[model samples]
Target: MSGQPTKFLVPLLLPISWLFAGLVAIRRALYQHGFYKQETLPVPVIVVGNVMVGGVGKTPITMALVNHLKAQGLRVGVLSRGYGRKTSSTLAVSPSSQSQNVGDEPLLIARSCQVPVFVGNSRVDAGRALLSLYPDVQVLVCDDGLQHWPLARDLELCVFDERGVGNGHLLPAGPLREAWPRKALRHATSGQEVPCLVLRTAGIAGPHEFAVQRHLADFAVQANGAKRSLSSWWDTPVQALAGIAKPEKFFAMLREQGLNVTHSQALPDHADLQNLHIDTAQGDVLCTEKDAVKLWAHHPQAWAVPLQTTLPTELLAAIDFHLAAAQHAKLSSPHGHQTA
Candidate 1:
C-alpha cells in the first residue's frame, strides 16, 4: 500500500488509526510512569529513526554518524533489531555475516563502517551484547529505534525524506507512526528528558530541521570490491532494480545520473532476491548497495550504487555538544563512576 493511505481509504481507516494512537499513547505512558522498565547502557546512545514507517535514509545517516564519531576519535558501535532476519537470537554482525542471519542493513553497516554491530529482537539486548563484546566503544548508534522506548537514548535524530509526514495521520490512515513534533522521552537512567534533532534527508529543509545532501556515488561497486565509474554506463542500457521502501526514488536517481535504464523493477522493501532472475540479454543489472548484500550471492555481476550522504557541520557540532554533556553527566553519576 506504499505506506501512504489513499484519500479514499483515509476516511475508512481514521477510526482504527485513532485506536492505534490511543494504544501508542498508553504504551508511552507506561514507560514514563515506570510501569515498563527502560534499560540504559554505560555508553551514550544516539537513535536515528523516523516518525513515519518505512525507510527515510536512516541507515545511511546511521553509518555517516558512526564515521563522524570515529573521526572524532571515539570508539563507536551499532545496535539494531535485525529486522527481516530469520533468527531471533542476539548475534554479532561481521562482514561475512549473511543477510538472512544478521539482516541486510546490519551486515551492510558492519561491512561499510568496519565497526562492531550486534542485533536482536530487542534493541536493549542488542545494545548490551554489543557493549559486552566491544567494551571500549564510547558510543552506540541504534539504526532504527525512535519508538523503541525500552532502550533509552541520550540523543534522538528524527529523519525525514521528501514525503514529510504524509497526510499527517497515523498508521492505516497515513504514513505517520507517531505524531509530528513528538513529546520528549525520558532518559533511562537519569529520568531527564532526552533531546531530539530533526533532520531532512531529502526534499526542502524545514526551518527547524537540518537538511542532508544525498546523491548516488559517482562509482558503482562489485561483489569483489571492484569499482567502476557510473559514467561508463551512460550510453549502455542497464536493468535497474531496487527492493526498498521507495524504489522509484532510486530509479529516478539513476536516471538523473544519465544512466540508460531500459528496465526498472521495484520490488517490496527488503524483498528476498535469492531467486531473482534478470535477463542479462536486456542489459547490465544495477541495484542499491543494500540489495547488493543479498543479490551478490545470486547476481554477483550486479553493480551496486552506494548512496552518499552529507550532513551539515552544524548538526555534527550540535551532536558533539550533546555528547559532551551526556558524558559529563554519566561520569558524575555514582553508578556510572563505579562502572567506569
Candidate 2:
C-alpha cells in the first residue's frame, strides 16, 4: 500500500502474478463447469472493450459502430455496466439518463446515436430489458463488457489507442484488467463464438484493421446547445479539461486546433463536475462533449467540443460481413422468425 517501489519487487511480482493467474484459471474453470453461466441474448452482441485498462479509445469506437449499424438500417441497442452509476438495476438511457444512473459512457452513446441504451451491473439483464423494450433491435453493443462474462458476444472488438497493452502486465503492475493471452482463447469459448477486431480509431492502416480519426466540432456548444465559435475563445487563454480515459488526447487535439490553452485538467473518466471548481474569472473553460453531460449542471459557461469520429471502412466491412452472416443465421435457425 506504499508508493515506493523496491528492487526486489520484480522477482516477488512474478510469483505473485503466477498466483493471480492461477486464480484467473480457476475462475475460468468454474464458469466452464456451469457454476457461472454465460448468458446469451436473442440478439447479436458486439463487445467493444480493451484488454488494457483505460484510454484505449473504446467510447469513440462504440459510438462509431452504433452510427454505422444505424446507417446500415440495423436496429441497434447498447448495453453497459454503467461503471460509475449509483444504481445497480437496469435503467433506460434517455436524454434524462443521468451520468449518476446510466453511467457516462451509456449516456454518451444515447446522446450521440439516438438509439436505445440500458445500463446495469449485469449486461445480460440490461440486454434483455433493452431488447424487450425495443424488440426490433437486431444487434446489441455492450459498451465496455469485454470482460463482463455474463453476457455473450458474437464479436469481441479489442480497441487500443496508441498504447498497445502497456508494459504487457496485469493490474497493479500494468494497465490490463486481465492477461493479454487470454483474449484470443476466451473469445473462442461460451457456446456463443466470438471474433476479434484489433481496431484503432486513429492513425490506423492496412487490412484486418483500419485507421480512423476523431474531430471536434468547429463550434463549441454550451449545455443549452448554443453554439459558440472556436474563434470566440481565441482572445483568452482557456482551461481545457476532460474526465475521459483519453483526456490527454482531448487536450492534444485542442492544441492541434490552434487554441492557446492556459491549463489542462485530466480527471478520471466520467468525473462528476460538481466536484470541480473552475476559476471562471481567470479564463474560459473547455471540455469534451462526454464531460458535457454533467458539466452543464455545474458550469453553464463551459464549452464542450463535440467529437466527430469515423471508423475505418475496412473495419466496417468486416462488421458488415458479420451482420450479414448473423442475419443469415437468424433466418436459418429454428427459433428465428425474421430477417433484415
Candidate 3:
C-alpha cells in the first residue's frame, strides 16, 4: 500500500510530463524562430531563477547580487513578476508598500537592498517602468524569470537548493519547471548568445556550478525595526513558524543556532497569515524575513530572522565580465542612449 500510490501516479503522470516537454520545446522553437518576440531593455538584465519548482532561496540570492552590484558603484534596479501579489498592475515597490500589493519577496527586497524594485506581470514592462522613473539605473536584476522568454536577459543565474533537479523530470511527475541543461538564450535585440551560470544555493555545488553559503543572522528583527540578538532567546522557549517551501530547513537552522524551539509550525508557501491564529503562549514567535513582511502586519510580535548569503568572488567576476561586455555592446550600438 505504501508504494502503491507511487507506482500508480508515476505511470499516470509520465505521459503528461512528456506532453509538457513537447509544449516547452514548441514554445522555445517559437521564440528561436522569431515567431514570438523577446523584448529588450536599454540596461542589461540579470535574471536569477531556477528550473526546479518551489522556493530555492532565489530571493536571498537576488538581494545578495543587488547589494554586490551597488557596492561596485553601479546604480541597480530590480524587476519582478511579484508572485502571489494581489495586484496585477505594474508598480514600484517602496519601503512603505504593503506585501499584499507588491508581493512579499519584492517588498522584502526593496526594504533589505534599498534598491529600486518594480512589479508587473511582464518583466519587460516592469523594467521599462523602473528605468523611466530611475533613469540613472545602470543595470536591472530580475528576481525570478528564467522561463519568461518574452524578456531578453544579458545574464542568467540558475539557482538550486539541496534538491538539485529532483528526479530530473518535468511537472506532474517531478520538480522541474523546465528542462535542465537547456540551450543558451539569445539577446532579443542584439541576437547575441546570453551567458548563464549555475549557482548551488545550498549543500555542495555540482560540476561547473558556483556555491552560495547561507546562514541566519545573529539577530532577529521586530516589526518596529528593533533588533534582538539570537542569544537573547536562549532562555526562552521559541515557537518557530515558517511560511516557506522548506520550513524544516529553517527549523533545523534554528536548532543549529542553539534555539529551544518548543513548537514549530510549517505553513504553506506564500500563505496568508492574516486570518490564521498563532498561539503566543507556545513561545517567542520567530519566522523568516520573507514571512515577516506579511506576518508582521497582523502579528507584530513576531521576530523575523534574516538569511545572510555569501556569493563566490569568482561568480561576481564572471558577472562583471558579462556586464562589461554588455556595456560595450550597448555603447557601440547606434540605437543605444545613455541612462547612467
Candidate 4:
C-alpha cells in the first residue's frame, strides 16, 4: 500500500519519528568509532537491503543477483545475519536446515541457490567461513543487511516494495530504519544514514524508481518439485496458508490466479507449521514458496506458489556498473575492508 500524508495520523507521528531518527543517529555514531563493534569480511560483500520494513521482495532480488553473478561465472556465496534463527554461532545453512535453525530466508535462498549459504549473528563471520570453504568464491551476497555495518560491504543494493521510506520515520513510528533526509545529507556508506541502491520491482534506481509487480505463479510446486495448477483447485473452497509478511497479499494473489480460497491463515513471520495440522484431507491446501521450504517437510502434498519479480533493465545496468566498480576498487587496493 502507498503511504500518504493522511488527514489524521501523519502529523501525530512526526515527533515520535524525530525521536527515532535521533536514536538511529546515536547508534550509528557509536558504530563509526569503537563504541559498537563491526566486523570486516575477507572478501567483497554485496548487501541487498531496504529502508522500509516488510517484504520488498528481497529474496527474489537476492536470488536474481546470485544467479546473475553465477551466470557471469563468478563463484558466489550468500551470508545473512540469521535474524530469527535459534543458534547464535556462524554456520552454513543446510538444505535440511529448519527455519528455526538457519532462519526462513536463508533456508529459502539455500534451496533455490545451490551455492553455499550461511547464517550467523555475524555476516562477517559467515562470509569468512564461506570464503575459506570455497576459496574460489569471489562475491558474497548479504540478505537484509543495510543497517548491519559490522560486516563491511563492497556494493549495497537497497530494495523498496512500493513502500518507499514509509512515513519517512525511523523504527517504531514508521517503516524506515533511519531518517531519509539525513541519509541523503550524510555520505554514510556502510549503515549510518545511506542511499545504498533503490530498487523498484522493474525500474531504474539512480533517479526516481518504479515498482515491479510480483505475481504468483499459476501453479504450486510439490515436495518432489512437481507442479500442480492453481486452476485445479478452483472448484473447491480450501485453506490458503501463509507465514510470511503480508499474508493477505498471498491470499489476494491466490484469488487472482483463480483459487477458490475460503480459509486464509496468516501466521507470524517465521511460523513453524510443522505442528499445525489442517483438515486438508477435505480439500486442497496451498501455501507460499518460502513457506513450502518449511511446511512441505511435514505435508509433502502442500501446494506452494512461487513468486517471480522482474527487475528493470535500467537497474540491471546500474548493478553491472556498481559491481564492476566494486571489483575494480578491490583489485586496485591491496589492503581492503568491507561490511554487510
Best by lDDT: 1
- In Å, residue 101's CA in model 2 sits off its true spot by 1.6
Per-residue lDDT over 1-340 for candidate 1, one digit per residue giving the tens place of the 0 to 100 score? 3488769999999999999988999998898788999887887889999998888899999999999999999888999988899999999999999999999999999999999999988998988888777777888899998899898899999999888989999998988888876888988778788999999987899898999988999889999889999999998999999998889989999999999899999998888898888899989889999999999988899999999989899999999999989988877777562232
- 1-340: candidate 4 lDDT, tens digit per residue: 3334463766687787788778878887776666766655555678888777766678888988898888888788998887777789988887888888888889989988898998878777788888777777778898888877676666677777645565665655567777664343122233333235667763344366644556777778888988877788878787888987778888988888877787878887778777977886657778887888888878898887888766666767777776777666665665543333
Models 1 onward score TM values of 0.96, 0.89, 0.96, 0.86
The better-scoring model by TM-score among 3 and 4 is 3
Among these predictions, the greatest TM-score belongs to 1
Whole-model lDDT per candidate: 0.90, 0.76, 0.88, 0.74
Q: Write the per-residue lDDT of candidate 3 for residues 170-216, one digit (tens) a residue.
A: 87677777788798887877787899999998778988999999999
- Model 1 deviation from native, Cα RMSD in Å: 1.6
Ranking by lDDT: 1, 3, 2, 4
Worst 10 residues of 4 by lDDT: 185-194
lDDT of 4 at 181: 42
Question: How many clashes in each candidate?
Answer: 0, 0, 0, 8
- Report the alpha-carbon TM-score of model 1 versus the true structure: 0.96
TM-score for candidate 4, please give it: 0.86
Q: How high is the lDDT of residue 71 in model 4?
A: 84
Ranking by TM-score: 1, 3, 2, 4
